[model samples]
Target: MATHSSVAHANLTVRQTLLHQLFGDHHGWLFERLRARLGCPSDAADMASETFVQVVALDDPHSIREPRALLTTIAKRLMYASWRRRDLERAYLDALANEPEQFAPSAEQQVMAVEALIEIDRLLDGLSSRARAAFLYSQLDGMTYADIARELGVSAPRVHQYVVQGLRACFEART
Candidate 1:
């Protein structure tokens, strides 16, 4: 008399069991490998746990033939994300420090702004450097295509194309 919810719960339990076993078997090895490369034990451990989380989200984690390779790839991506977030935070704090005291954003607003900037960075990730620059100039600085072209040393048409491409990238990312 198992309901559909019960069946789904059972299936999820099985998947969790398999993932837990995998973690139990290789977590130490993965942690040590990350530690050696990153030179920080705590960071390595965090990445290793995040790696397992990523794998568990995969549609077919059991199908991986080279678990270590898969683990390494996931952990590396997590490490990169951590680095990006830290670098972005540092830049944001520096900018805040330089702002006029009366015009400064509140602490909560600063946190929200940093988070928004991080998301914007993620949304723009696949663009060429120039395209990203063009988009940022147009959107953030309210620059015209002609002005962006002059600044970037490109043709106005080229700048427009970059802006269009960047818009498309953002649209695709959103949908």
Candidate 2:
């Protein structure tokens, strides 16, 4: 009879074997598919690797019946996230471009600011467009509910609700 440690080791070995087999069977196909969609071999390779990483995080990889469909879904989500981050960074840089040289952030500060923005974006992921806009306008632009309502073409109470919803999302994300 196997000891507890031996049984755990055997289970780990089995999971590793399954993961290796899955990677070997699908990595090339996924890489080529991504390459075709992205038009960049390096980006395709990175996306394929990230896709497998997501698979590895699954509780039961063996239960997947349609691997390609799952891989495509995961890759598309990653691609969208990448595009969003790039857009955020570009916008931040454009804003900074208008600042005087004396007030320009250092490279490290810029990186930290971008990372913080990404985290904020993740925290606000499920908010509606108006809710997000209301929250940003209120918090960043110092707009009142009346002003936000006028800008969003909604009632002041509705703007208040949106701002509260945005705050709730951020609070839940923190916890």
lDDT of 1 by residue, 32-115 (tens): 999998999988888887888888889977687888888878888888888898899999899878989999998899899989
Cα RMSDs, all models: 2.7, 1.2
Which residue ranges in model 1 land beyond 4 Å of their true spot?
A: 1-14
| Cα deviation of 27, candidate 2, in Å | 0.5
TM-score of each: 0.85, 0.94
Q: lDDT tens string, model 2, 81-159? A: 9999999999999999999999999999999999998988888889999999999899888999999999999999999
**CA lDDT of each candidate?**
0.89, 0.94
Candidate 2: minimum summed lDDT over ten consecutive residues — where? 59-68
Q: After aligning candidate 1 to the native by TM-score, how far in Å is the CA of 12 from where it should be?
A: 5.1
lDDT value, residue 72 of candidate 1: 79
lDDT, residue 44, candidate 2 = 98
lDDT of 1 at 58: 96
